[model samples]
Target: MSASSLKLRMMIVTALFAAIIGVLAQVTIPLPLVPITGQTLAIGLAATILGWRYGTLSILLYLALGAIGVPVFAQMSAGVGILFGPTGGYLFSFIPTALCIGLYLEKTSFNLKNAIIANIIGMFISLLLGTVWLKYIAELSWGAAFASGVAPFLIVGLIKAVLAAWIGIMVRQRLASANLLYA
Candidate 1:
């Protein structure tokens, strides 16, 4: 593909993943502070398949949409207020989490083991950042923050990470074979 074509393809793919993330964010179980959502799973999948650049771009776009009052967040909540809300840390963390996973996949081979490890790393980083955010925003103690923000999501996060890794690698492989992936 020519340079312009490649750029267009990248743009399209990025926008698609951003939409995917937005849609996935709607799949949530309402909780007191941090709801369980499929957003991270989508983030992992996007990062693994799109690599760091486009994956991060996709997440950034998704966040931007939510910031501008799009009903793209968990339970259809949106606007800059959400960023200052209790769950905002987790939402904001998606960018770095996607970058971490995408960078890992970019540096290493896109295999199951590598994908899982990358996803795990990304999940942990997000959880840590999110926990801190929760603690301050909610004015809770560290233990309370972990209980409300991190503990409940641990198992679900692991499951999503594994699933995202497996699916992401599969998708990446297929896209690469079709010459549809960016470098």
Candidate 2:
């Protein structure tokens, strides 16, 4: 493929993943402090399929859309306020989470094993950053923050990580086979 075509394909795929993140983010199970959303799963999928550069781009695009009041965030919430809200750290953490996941897979291999490991790491990154932010922002004790923000999501997060790894690898393989992705 030409360089220009490759860039175009990357852009298109990045945007698609951004949209996918937005759509999945709405799948939420409400909690006291942090609702369980599909955003982390989408982040894992984006990284597993798109790798670091485009995966991070997809997250940036998703955040930008929400910042611009696009209703692309959880519960259809948007604007800069959300980015600075209690859950903002989780949202902000997605950048590094996606970047690390993609970079890990890129440096190692884009297989199920690596993807699962990368997603697990990414899940912890989100939880750690988010819990800290929630503690300060919500003016809660550390134990309270961890209890509400991190503890509740552990099992579900693991499930989502595996799902993201499995589905992401399958989709990536198909895309590569169809000449839509360069792998």
Q: Estimate each model's TM-score.
A: 0.97, 0.98
In candidate 1, how many Å is residue 115 off?
A: 0.4
Kindly list the per-residue Cα lDDT of model 1 for residues 1-183, writing each as its tens digit: 798887888889899999999899989888888999999999999999998999999999999999999999988889999988898999899989999999998899789999999999999989999999999999999999999999999999999999999999999888877877764
**What local lDDT does model 1 show for residue 65?**
95
* lDDT string, candidate 2, 1-183, tens digits: 897897888899999999999999999988866899999999999999999999999999999999999999999999999999999999999999999999999999999999999999999999999999999999999899999889999999999999999999999999988777767
- Please give the distance, in angstroms, between residue 153's alpha carbon in candidate 1 and its true position after superposition: 0.5
Full-model lDDT for every candidate: 0.93, 0.94
Q: Lowest summed lDDT over 10 consecutive residues: which window, candidate 1?
A: 174-183
RMSD (Å) per prediction:
0.9, 0.7
* Residue 28 displacement (Å), model 1: 0.8
